[model samples]
Target: MRFNKELKNIKIYEAGKPIELVVREFGIDEKDIVKLASNENPYGTSPKVVEAVKLVVDKMSLYPDDSMFELKKGLSNKFKVKSENIIIGAGSDQILEFACRAVLNDNTKVLMNKITFAMYEIYALQQGAKVLKTRCYRHDLDEFYDIYKKASPDIVFICSPNNPTGDALGKEYIYTFLEKVKEPLVIVDGAYMEYAGYKDEKKRVEPKDLIDKFENVLYLGTFSKAYGLGGLRVGYGIANEEIIKNLYKLRPPFNITTLSLKAAVEALKDEDFVNDSVKRNFTQMERYVNFAIQRGFEYIDSYTNFITYIFPKEVSSKELSNRLLQRGIIVRDLTGYGMNALRITIGTKEQNDKFFEKFKEVLNGY
Candidate 1:
């Protein structure tokens, strides 16, 4: 049987290389490999979440709380929104799917920047929808204004602290833009917003702040980043109740596992753990940015856990990525994103040193 034509264009996602793969490829010990890809919190999960997981470990024979009652309540308490306004998924990526499946289709279109998250394009194409990417590197509201109105997209995605390029949108800019467009639903992917303002909550704009003002908007978040729970894959979406109610129908009954549910709920309660992770990430990311500047290497000022640096014309990102990998340092290659950059996750101090020693070696030898 022939597959749907949409499958022809949908490319498989290229994830960061696992530590095991690196160890096996280069004959290096697992411990010697430094993984500065995927933007995972190198710090272990919160102590509270560990305890919560152990408590649920004994109940693996049974199914998870399909309704996600406690997790929703915990999120509500933390974000100061009603429980009904929240939806949990295996990861925020899955929540993204639910959103697309609920609204996007063959006839509609979606909007994002030229180099935002690749998943937005993958999901939209999977549903046979057209993706209206902005002309510039960043999705400047002013630039998208006329083009967006002309296209009349069904949905718009704002990947604040955009992937591959970590620049974020300003609050006033978004508010003013919102005033102009009142039709299409806007979904803000704030996966890394916490890291952008690691020490200051006021620096990050919450989706709750916009929901009441704008009737057609949803906020997607992931516990994988700040919570140190990427292995568990817990994520959430917050929006107006009416939009939430419709999206809920697309959710599978037991999408989130029991351990993940427990970890995410406890993670929400222990905001201090997340804060510490963000604080440390910010400190480390700053050093990398400075190092890039001193070396005269072009790089983006990251608001997230990872920084993307453009290699000089002499060395392609492929060559840089290859050199780092030979030394057991795994970072993201941006070829798939159509960028001449290499993205490095801001790991701990020691880990950062390991990358630098090898990265400098690559540049020096070149």
Candidate 2:
């Protein structure tokens, strides 16, 4: 059997290790594992979403509403955009795939920060498109513009509150950059925008405002982050009607499950639950910041649910992460991303306390 040449080089994304996997491997009780790897809402989904899913579980045998009217309507109302400007996907990543498919061809090129979301390059490669990246690890619009002019890429990705290293670009700065680049499709992945918005008002990227200002821009959003619906996998893309229409051409019917649609719609209704969750995230996040400071470790000021702590040359992040894992704690080791760092999701107060205790022992070589 022959595989596509692109498939040979594509590295599979390794998601955070599940608690059950840790239990089986290290003989730890499931209850004893503290998972702070994936940037999931420490508190699970809203009660309303849970109840909504319960009512729809019996309908799993039936296909979901292919039109996705209710969820689109809820998103339209919340974001103040027309329903025609939206397209639902299994997750925001699927919508990203759609965008890549719609614009990219074998000869096409896409630009992104060197260390943004891995999926951006992965999806572009599936279309056989060339990937160009900025020299800096963080989002540098000036560098992006310089490359954009020379390469004339078909798409440019801006992952604000960028993953792994949790810094973000202000919307105003992004808008200025958008003004300069008019032809290419600029994809702004706001997967962690809710947490960024809650942390600082200036970091918020209003989809309605963005799409209204630029026809070529697509804003990707997700319920997986702050809404606590990661398990259900609900995400959407917001853009102009034309962009939405082209993306819909590639969208398969019933891509999202019946329960996911119901849960996302319910998640939208209870803004209080979302807001409270964001508030608690930042509150717990401060402890992680303080821990890093007191330990003389350098860390990024995060706008997302997770914080990245960069270890010095002498300390091995891989060794520390392994030690933590053996103690029934799971945090992301950034060695795969080529950084001597660990990206840890800010968990609940008790969970964080356990991490701090275990992390300290590992740091002290216990």
Best by TM-score: 2
lDDT, candidate 1, equals 0.87
RMSD per prediction, one decimal? Answer: 1.3, 0.9
**Per-candidate local distance difference test:** 0.87, 0.93
RMSD of 1: 1.3
Error of 1 at 358 (Å): 1.0
Sequence-dependent TM-score of model 1 = 0.97
Residue pairs in candidate 2 whose N, alpha carbon or C atoms collide under 3 angstroms: none
Residue 19 Cα positional deviation in candidate 1, in Å, after optimal superposition: 0.8
Cα-based TM-score, every candidate: 0.97, 0.99
lDDT of 2 by residue, 1-366 (tens): 998887777889889899999999999999999999999899998998888789989999999889989999999999999999999998899999999989998899999998878899899998899999988988999999999999999999999989979999998999999999999999999999998998899999999999989999999999999999888888999999999999999999899999998999899999999999999999998998898889889999999999999988889999989999999999999998889999999999999999999988987774
Best model number under lDDT? 2
